[model samples]
Target chain A: MLNELKNLISKEILLEWRQKYSFGGILLYVVSTVFVCFLSFKKIVDVPTWNALFWIIILFASVSAVAKSFIQESRGRLLYYYTIASPQSIILSKIIYNSFLVCFLSVLSLGVYSVMIGNPVQNLSMFFLTIILGSLGLSSVLTLVSAIASKAANNLTLMSVLSFPVIIPLLIILIKLSKNSIDGIGWSVNYRYFISLFSLDMIVIILAFLLFPYLWRD
Target chain B: MKHWWKFVAVLFVLYAIIAGFLMDVPALPILHETIRNLYFHVTMWMAMMVLMTISLIYSIRHLSGFKNEHDIVASEAANTGLLFGFMGLVTGMIWARFTWGTWWVADPKLNGAAITILIYLAYVVLRNSIDEEQKRAKVSAVYNIFSYIMLLVFLLVLPRMTDSLHPGNGGNPAFSTYDLDNNMRMVFYPAVIGWTLLGVWMMTLKIRIKKIKLKKGL
Candidate 1:
C-alpha cells in the first residue's frame, strides 16, 4: 500500500512536471492577483484588510489549483487509475500532491503579497504555519469535492459551489489564527486554533479515505 | 397504527402555536414579544439539523450497502432539510432585523447558518448535474458524507472560536441559560420534537414517492 501510494504521488508530480503550464498558470494566477490588489489599493491597507485580502487571494488560487486534481483527468485516465490503484491510495496521493501544490502556491503568494502590499504579520513563522494548515485543509476538502464534481462532468461552477460553503469553517479558523499571528499573540492564546485546524484537517482526510472507495468503484 | 407519530407531530405543533403565542414570556429588554419566535424560528433550525443528520446517515448506509433506497431517503431528507434551512434563515433574518436593527449581521453564527444552507444547496445542485443514475447516487452519497462533516464543523465548532452575536456561542448567553423559563421550555422542547417529526414525515413521504417512481420506471 505504501509503495503504491508513493508511486501514485510521484506520478502526480510527474504529470505536473510534464504539464508545466497548468502549475505555472497557478503561479501566474497568484502573482497577477496580488499585483491587481496592489493596483487597486495603491497604498498599504490596514492590518485587517491586508490579512483578509491575502487569504482571499490564496483561497481562490487554491480552489482553482485543487479543483483540477480530479477534473483535469480524462475519463480514460480515470478508468486506468481505477483499474490500477486502490481508491485509498488514489485519494491520499491526490490530497498529498494537492497540499504540496497549494502550500507552495500560498507561500509564494504570501511573499508577493508582502512585497506588493507591505507585510503586517508580526509572527512570520506562525503565519506560515497557519498557511500550511490552511493549505492541507483546503486540499483535503477540494480533492474530494473535485472527485465528486468530476463525476458530474467536470463542471467548474459545481466545484466552487460544492467547495466554498464546506471550506468556510476552515477559512474562519485560518483567518483567526493568522490574525493572532499578525498580533503576535502568545502560543497559549493560539494553540486552540491550531488544534481545531489540525483536527478539521484530520476529519476531512479520514472522511476522504473512507468515502473515496465508493466514489472510485462507480 | 404505524402513523401515530405523525398525529403526535400535528398535535405538538398545534399546541406550540397556541401556547407559544398565548403563554406568558419573561419581559426582556430587546426581545420583549419577539421571544415567542424561539418556538418557531429556532425549532426550524433544530428540525433542519436533525433532518440533515438523517440524510447523512442514509448516505452512509448507501455507501456501505449500495442500496438505491438509502440514496433516495438521503436525497429526500436533504431536500426536506433544505426547506427547513431556508425557513430558519428567513425567520432568523426577520428576528435579527427586529432585535439587532439589521437584516443581516456578519456574526459567525449567522454566517455559519448561511453557509450550512449553501452546503446543502450545493449537494442538491450536485445531484441534478449528474445524469447517470447509479453514478449520481454513489457520487452524491460521497459528497453528502463529506459536506455533513464540514457542516458540523461550520455550525458547531467555528462559531465558538470567535465572539458571536448569537446566543450560546462565545461569550453570549444562551436563551436557555436565563430566558428559557419553565413556560418556554415546555413549548420549546415540544416544538423541537414536533418540528423534527414533521420534517421526517415530509421526508418519508418524498422517499416513498421516489421509491414508487423507481419501481414504476417513471
Candidate 2:
C-alpha cells in the first residue's frame, strides 16, 4: 500500500512537472489576488483584518486549485487508473499532492500578503502551524468534493456548494488560530484550537480514504 | 403493534406540547416565557440530527450492499432532515427575535444550524446534478457520509474551542453546563425523542413513496 501510494504520488508530481504552466497559473493567482488586496486595503493595520483577509485569499485559491484536480481528468485516464491502482492509493495520492499544492500556494500568498498589507502576526511559528493544518484540511475536503463534482458533470458552482458546509468549520478554526497567533497568545490558551484542527484534518483524510473507493465504482 | 412506535411518537409530542407550556419554568431574565420555545425549537434540531444520522447509516449501507432501497432511504431521510432543520431555524429565529432583540446574531449556534442546513441542501443538489441512477446514488451516498462526520466535528467539537474565544457568548445559553431544571427536563427529554421519531416516520413515508414511483417506472 505504501509503495503504491508513493508511486501514485510521484505519477501525480510527474504529471504536474510536465504541466508547469498549471502550477505557475496557481502561483500567479495567489500573487495577483494579494496585489489586488494590497491595492484595495492600502495597508491593513488591524491584526484581525490581516488574519481574515489572509485566510479568505487562501481559501479561494485552494478551492479553485482543487476544483481542477479531479474535474480535469479524462474518463479514459480514470478507467486506466482504476485498473492499475487501488482506489485508496489513488485518493491518498491526490490528497497528498493537493495538500502540498495548497501549502505552497498558502505560503506564497502569506509572503506577498504580509509584504503588501504589513506583517501583523505576532507569533510566526503558530501562524505557520495554522497554515499547514489549514492547507491539509482544505485540500482533503476539496479534493473529495472535486471528485464528487466531476462525477456529477458540473464543475465550479457545484464544487463550491458541496464543499462550503464541510469547509466552514475548518475555515473558522483556521481563522481563530491565526487570530490567536496574530495576537501572540501562548500555547496554553490555544491548545484546543490546535487539537480540534488536527482532529478535523484526521477525520477528513480518513473519510476520504474510506469513501473514495465507493466513488471509484462506475 | 406494527405501528406502535408511531402512536407513541404522537403521544409524546402531544404531552410535550401541553406540559412544555403549562409546566413551570425557571423564569430567567431574558429568556422569560420564551424558554417554552426550547421544547419546539431545540427538539427540531435534535430530530434533524437524528434523521441525518439515519441518512448517514443508509448511505453507508448503500455503499456496502449497492441496494437501491438503501439509496432511496438515504435520500429521503436527508430530505426529511432538511425539513426538520428548516423548522428548527424558523422557530429559533422567532425565539431569538423576542429574546436577543434581533432576528439573527453572529452566534455559534446559528452558525452550526446554518451549516447543517447548507450541507443537506448540497446533498440534494448533488443528487439532482447527476444523470445516471447508480452513479447518483453511489456518489451522493459517499457525500452523505462524508458531510455527516464533518457536521459532527463542527457542531460537537468546535463550540468548546470557540467558547473561551468569544466570552460574550452571544447571549447563547449553555443548557448543558448550567443545567436544565428537572421540570423542563421532563418535557425536553421527551420532546427530543418525540420529534426525532416523527422525523423518522416522515422519512419512511418518503422512502415508500419513492419506491412506489420507481416501481411505476417514473
Candidate 3:
C-alpha cells in the first residue's frame, strides 16, 4: 500500500510537471486576482479585510486548480490508472498533490498580495502556518468533491457548487486563526483554533480515504 | 403504531402553537414578546437538524448496500430538511430583526446556519446534474455523507469557536442557563419533537410518492 501510494504520488507530480502551463496558469490567476484587488481597494485596508481577501483569493484559486484533479481525466486514462493503482492510492495522491499545489499558490499569492495590498498580518509565521493548514483542508475536500463531480459528467461548476458549502466551515476557521495572527495574539490564545483546524483537516482526509474507494468502483 | 406518531406530531404542535402564544413568558429586555419565537424559530432548526441526520444515515446505508431505495430516502429526507432549514433561517431572520434591530448579524451561529443551507442546496444540485441513475445514486450518496459531516461541524462545532449573538454559544447566555423557563420548556421540548416528527412524516410521504413514480416507470 505504501509503495503504491508513493508511486501514485510521484506519477501525479510527474504529470503536473509535464503540464507546466496549467500550474503556471493558476499562479498567474493568483497574481492577477491580487492585482485586481489592489486596483480596487487601492489604499491599505484593515487587517480583517486583508485577511479575508487573501483567503478568498486562495479559495477560488485552489478550487480551479483542484477541480481538474479528476475532472480533466479521460475515461480511458482513468481506466488505465484504475488497472494499475488502488482507489485509495489514487485519492491520496490527488489530495497530496493538490495540497502541494494549494500551499504553493497560497504562498505565492501572499507574497503578491502583501506587496500590492500591504500586509497587516502581525505574526507572519503563524499566518503562514494557517495558510498551509487551510490548503490541506481545502485540497482534501475539493479532491473528493471533484471526483464526485467528475462522475456526474465532469461539471466544473458543480464542483464549485459542491465544494463552497463544505469548505465554508474550514474557511471560517482559517479566517479566525489568521485574524488571531493579525492581532499578534499569544500562541496560547490560538492553540484551540489550531487544534480544531488540524482536526478538521484530519477528519476530511480520513473521510475521503474511506469513501473514495466506494466512489472508485463503477 | 406508525400512523400514531403522525397524530402525536399534530397534537404536540397544536398544543405548542396555542400555549406558546397564550402562555406567560418571562419579561426579558429586548426579547420581550418575541421570546415566544423560541418555540417556532428554534424548533424549525431543531427539526431541520434531525431530518438532515436522518438523511445522512440513509446516505451511509446507500453506500454500504447499494440500494436505490436508500438513496430515495436520503434524498427525500434532505429535501424535507431543506424546507425546515429555510423556514428556520427566515424565522430566525425575523426574530433577529425584531430583537437585534438588524436583518442580519455577523454572528458565527447565523453564518453557520446559512452555510449549512447552502451545502444542502448543493446536494440537490448535485443530484440533478447527474443523469445516470446508478451513478447518480452512488456519487450523491458519497457527497451526502461528506457534506453532512461538514454541516455538523458548521452547526454544532463552529459556533462555539467565536462569540455569537445567538444564545447558548460562546459568551451569550444560552436559553438552557437562564431562559427556557419551566413554562417555555414545556412548550419548547414538545415543539422540537413535533416539528421533527412532522418533517420526518413529510419525508416519508415524499419517498412513498417517489416509489410510486418509480413503480409506474415514471
lDDT of 2 by residue, B91-135 (tens): 988987898688888767688889999999999999999989999
Model 1: per-residue Cα lDDT over A1-218, one tens digit each: 99999999999999999999998899999999999999999766587788889889988998899988888898899889878988999999999999999999988988898788888888989988998889999999989988888889548999889988988888888888998999999888899889999999999999999988887766
Candidate 3 TM-score over all chains jointly: 0.96
Q: Supply the DockQ value of model 3.
A: 0.80
Candidate 2 C-alpha lDDT tens digits along A1-218: 99999999999999889999988888999999999989998989877788888888888899998888899988899889978999998999999999999999988988888677788888999989998998899999999999899898666899999998889989998998999998999999899889989988998999998888888868
Q: Is candidate 2 or candidate 3 better by DockQ?
A: 2
Ranking by DockQ: 1, 2, 3
lDDT per residue (tens digit) for residues B1-218 in model 1: 98899999999999999999999888877888988899999999999989999999999998888888898999999999999999999999999989989999889878878888888888889999988988998988888888888887777776666687887776554775554488889889998899999999999899888888889999
**Candidates ranked by TM-score, best first?**
1, 3, 2
- lDDT (CA) for every model shown? 0.88, 0.88, 0.89
- Against the native complex, each candidate's DockQ, computed on alpha carbons, is 0.84, 0.82, 0.80
lDDT (tens digit, per residue) of candidate 3 on B1-218:
75899999999999999999999988887788998899999999889888888889999999889899999999999999999999999999999999889999998888888888898898899899888899999989999888888888887887766677788766555676544478888888898899888998899899999999999999
Clashing pairs for predicted structure model 3, backbone only: B168-B174
The TM-score between candidate 1 and the true structure equals 0.96
Q: What TM-score do all the candidates reach, one by one? A: 0.96, 0.94, 0.96
